[model samples]
Target: MRKLGVKAAAAAVILASPAAAEMEYSFYIGSQSAPHSVLSGTIDGTAGTAIDSTVAWEGRSTAPPPYYGMRGVYWRESGWGYGLEFTHAKAYASDADRASLGFDSLEFTDGHNIITANIHRRWKNQWWNGRLTPFVTAGVGVAMPHVDIQHGGGAHTFGYQLTGPAARLGAGVSMAITDRMSAFTEYQFTYSDNKIDLDSGGTLETSLITNALNFGISYSF
Candidate 1:
């Protein structure tokens, strides 16, 4: 009879669980890619070693097959959402070519890595309502870019560390493949200025503007 009573209490507690407890925490990683545009345009596009450049970007949250598009995880409703995202990106300038003289004979490469954290608010049944599960978030991250420049018959390496603001927005769907696990995906953008300063006062600042195609998975407590 004692065992029966314990089982009955367990059933009652399970039935009484609050829906908000259903909110999940997520963790994820994607292809880490960053593209950069070097200013002071080598051949000289700016004054005082400033820059004049334009560039394109791609988000690096690269995924393997199977859950192909499962790049995002559901966020919590009321407070902080903790997770790690890996970013990869590349940059190039059509105007920064050898015709510019900076490349006597040329080859160059640029990429960056970033990690971030954010605060969230479930737009629907959220911290505000438990049924409207849509959500949005904004946060900040740090970036490390590896720069390789091959010019004037030599290779130069410059590593850059950048930190700045980032923002994300998306709608929430079912949070799991099954219970105890949940998933979500959102469109996010991180903006940072990656710069390299030279003792000669000549500098290269590739305001690494990044856009990511991020995706990942998570387990909740």
Candidate 2:
């Protein structure tokens, strides 16, 4: 009798557990605003002397452009979800401006590929009627940025492949279209700081802030 009671309690526990989890994949295309950084510091001059210079850098902010990104997520019935995401963009300048002495026509170009691990908190039920839900998302990730700096009438240039930490915060409203598909639009803000190592010696630090408005579709499988 005790064995039979234990079996019955086990069955009850299994039935009372949460429902099966779901997985979603999303694709989005949108515009990412420009990012800017300032460069300043002292470098090695002749015979171990340090020369200090002030430099101002303008990245994508010089001219705004469009960017695209995607995500794959897994959700449970408990109103929490986790995912992975990727984003790519470029920052360039057509004309170079120099702020530091002894440098002329300084140009900067950069490309970034970012990957992040994201977490989302969502409402357990549709708040406004049916089919409309709200969620907030945040993530921390790493970015691989390709950097190129040119100066001295294109005679001197430094290029480096760099890696840095990045983070973002976003909120959106999702609407159901069908049983397995949904759509959403979100606004996100991201920040990052990276250091570029010059082959000639020393390092350059860059800081960036970007804003994005993205619209996307998600499919559940």
Candidate 3:
């Protein structure tokens, strides 16, 4: 009788294992907005004085280089999950800043890219016949922004740079569309600390906080 009970328990474990874990892949696109931050740096090498100015950022979401993101997650039945996410977010210094600060070109429109490893917690709700799930996520990673700055009659500093550290927090809800598909909308807040090196000389330092609203679809397997 003891041997039979042990065998039955083993069979139950095997049967439940497949349903206990799953993998999900998602793609999303959205718009972003950033508040004004101070941008400070030195130009023309060590011969120049420090430049400090308040910069207003513009998010050209509808134009070229739109905002987008992708992620892959692995979920356990316990409502906990882990994933990697990549976001292509942009920022352009406003015209007022350019005219006032006398910058010929200043932007990270090509990429204010962020890559992070995220942890998520989700809850299953009875809304819409148990199809709605609400989740929150937090992550930390690095910022790789394309530094585009030309000022003080110096050479153009245009290239990708591993500027500094980045972190994000987000919350959203997902609706099940099919057995293996779901749709979601989320809001994310990201902070990046940038210490970018300039081509003609010293480094530019700034902290950017961005807010994004995103919608997308996911597939689970």
Cα lDDT tens digits, model 1, 196-221, are 44323344555555454445555655
Write down the RMSD of all candidates, one decimal each.
7.6, 4.5, 1.4
lDDT of 2 by residue, 100-149 (tens): 34444333344555678999888844765678878888999976665555
Q: How much is 89 displaced in model 1, in angstroms?
A: 3.8
State the weakest 10-residue window (summed lDDT) of model 3: 42-51
Off by over 4 Å in 3: none
lDDT of 2 at 38: 61
How do these models rank on TM-score, best leading? 3, 2, 1
Q: What's each prediction's TM-score? A: 0.54, 0.73, 0.95
lDDT of each model, Cα atoms only? 0.45, 0.65, 0.89
lDDT of 2 at 5: 100
Highest TM-score against the true fold, candidate:
3
Best by lDDT: 3
After superposing candidate 1 on the true structure, give the runs of residues whose Cα lies further than 4 Å from its correct spot.
1-38, 41-51, 56-86, 92-111, 123-133, 158-174, 198-201
